[model samples]
Target: MEPHIAFEDISKIYSNHVTTVAVEGVNFQIMPGEFISLVGRSGAGKSTLLKLLIAEERPTQGRVFFEGRDIATLDGSQEISSLRRKIGTVFQDFKLLSNKTVFENVAFAMEVAGKNDEEIAEDVPQVLELVGLSDKINNFPHELSGGEKQRVSIARALVHRPGVLVADEPTGNLDPANTFEIIRLLLKINEIGTTVVLATHNKEVINTLDRRVVSLDKGRLVKDDPRGTFIL
Candidate 1:
């Protein structure tokens, strides 16, 4: 089967004053419905790779294909925008709108995607429920706990039934209990068939993932294993 995401010999270089190579000759494929983890130390190019995947940053060389279409070949701003709709992202800091109610926050994502009132009304509630935040829909980010805020972020990400969810250090700020809750939710999402890609520094979380683990050191892929542990 063709992979949902393929990073072919990906490499990135930074230059302004002095040149720096961030990622070098990295190749990987993310399969649909798979739970995958990328582990590495600080400034190890993990974040750079994620940014490249989301098109936040362009690769200096190499290509990324999403379902066989070169990501670089996306026709225009509109096409790139549409591609993003199929991908959801959760960050270490829950990027929720401070003043919006949880329901409105999730609803806003669909609204921007041109979803009509009926669709937004029906889907937002289901996603909120999936993230265990149905009862907190009316609450603002300030009114919710850290875990609740992350759940709200997760719900917003799921509102579109994205084909893949990329969570970058999602549990970085929360305590262990809350971290585990987020991890459990990611696993649950994977079980339901959305490919999950996690980039994190937390060893315990990565070790417990029990999934395809890819370890990156500096800019190189040092390890790739089916039943991998977090050895970063």
Candidate 2:
């Protein structure tokens, strides 16, 4: 099968008074249904790599391909929207609306994607259950614990049933117990066939994952280990 996601000779440079190289000559391919841990130190280009994969930023050179199509060349809003819909994203920050309840938060994603009220009502509850948030569906962000908030975030990301899930520092704010729970949830998501790209600096998280490790240092691809540990 073709790669679900591929980065070919990728590089990103920001020019200001002085130039900054975010990532350079990075190449990797993510197969369908695989779990990958993107490991690196702070400012090690993890964010830049994800931005390129999602087309949030154009690489200064090279290409990002999703399922055999070059994403950088997609300039139309419809095309971009369609591409993004296939790749769900979860971040360290929950990014939930303060006033929205858990149910509404997850439902909002479907709404934004033009899902009808009927579909939202049907799918939102199921995703909340998947993320083990059925009990907190009516709770507000402030009312939930950090782990619960993150679970809601994961639920929202999965509501789309995207083919790929990109999680950036997802457990950054959680305690050890919560961190482990979140990692377990991510593994469960991966087991069911969503290609997961997890970008984090947590050594223990990477070590315990025993998944594919793609390490970056000073903006360059340094290692690609199939069952790797975090050594950065």
Candidate 3:
């Protein structure tokens, strides 16, 4: 069977007054419905690798493949946008538009992708309910709690039914209870068949996941195992 995602000998380097290598020669494969976590201390290239996967950063040396197509070699702007539609992304800061209501925040994603108003009208409310934010639809980002903000962000990401959701330190700013809640949401998304790639340092959360764990250190892949736990 073909893997859902794979990174082949990927590397990324940043050059300036001081040269830095973010990730080097890292490779891995993810099967369908598998939940994976990438763990490391700061500057371990976890985010760098995610950037490469989505084509935000070109690999300094190698390439990545999604659904068997080489992402680095993909042609056509519209096609690239199509690839992104299948992958959801959530970040630590809950990148919600501060001025918009939760409903508009989620619904606008569909609008940008050219989804019809009728489709957006049906989808946005369903997604907000999925994220447990139905009552808060009228709330602005500033009015919601941190956890609520993240859920709104997630609702937006899932509005198009992304095949995969990559989260980078999504719980970084949350309290312990909120952290668990967000992680639980990610797990729930995985249970629904959206491949989840979470980059985190919370050992307890990783231990609770009981899924594949990929460890990285200074741009190199150090460990990979089924039912893996977080360890550096």
Candidate 4:
């Protein structure tokens, strides 16, 4: 079977005055419906790898393939937009619009994708329910707890029903209890068949997962473990 996502000999370098390598010849493949974690210390190139996958930043060398097509070659905006629609991304920051209500925030994603009122109305509530934010749909970002804000972010990300969800440190700002709650929600999403790629530095969360761990060291792929732990 083919991998859902593949990084073939990928490398990224940035130069202005002094040159720095963000990722170095990293290669890995993520299968469909799998939950995987990318573990590394600060500045270990984890973010760069995700950026390459999303086409926010291109690889200085090699290619990133999603379902077989090389995303690096996707020059057209529509092509890139189409690829992004199939993948949802969550970041450490909630990235919620402070002015929009919970429902509007999630609905905004569908609206931007050209979904109509009826579709947005139906799908927004469903995804909000999935993230345990149904009752808070009318609430603004400032009116919610940290966990709730993150849930809203997740809800917005899932509004498109993406095949793959890339969460980069989704629990970074939450307390331990809330952190676990968010992780459990992610696990539930994975169980329901969304491929989840989580990049985190939390040892307890990573160790507790005991899932596939892709370890990176100074921008290089150091270890790929099926039942992996957080070892830096």
User: Of models 3 and 4, which has the larger TM-score?
Assistant: 4
Residue 118 of model 3 has an lDDT of 93
> Per-residue lDDT of 28-105 in model 3, one digit per residue for the tens?
998888899999888999989888777778888987999998997778777777777778888888889888999999
Candidate 1 lDDT over residue span 74-121, tens digit each: 888888888778889888888898889999999987987899999998
Quantify all predictions' global Cα lDDT against the true fold: 0.89, 0.92, 0.88, 0.92
User: Please, what is the TM-score per model?
Assistant: 0.96, 0.96, 0.96, 0.97
Q: How many backbone clashes does candidate 2 have?
A: 0
Which residue pairs collide in model 2, if any? none
**How much does each candidate deviate from the true structure in C-alpha RMSD?**
1.1, 1.1, 1.3, 1.1
lDDT of 4 at 22: 91
- What is residue 139's positional error in candidate 4, in angstroms? 1.6
Report the lDDT tens digits of candidate 4 across residue range 28-92.
99999999999999889988988888889989999999989899789788989888878888889
Off by over 4 Å in 2: none
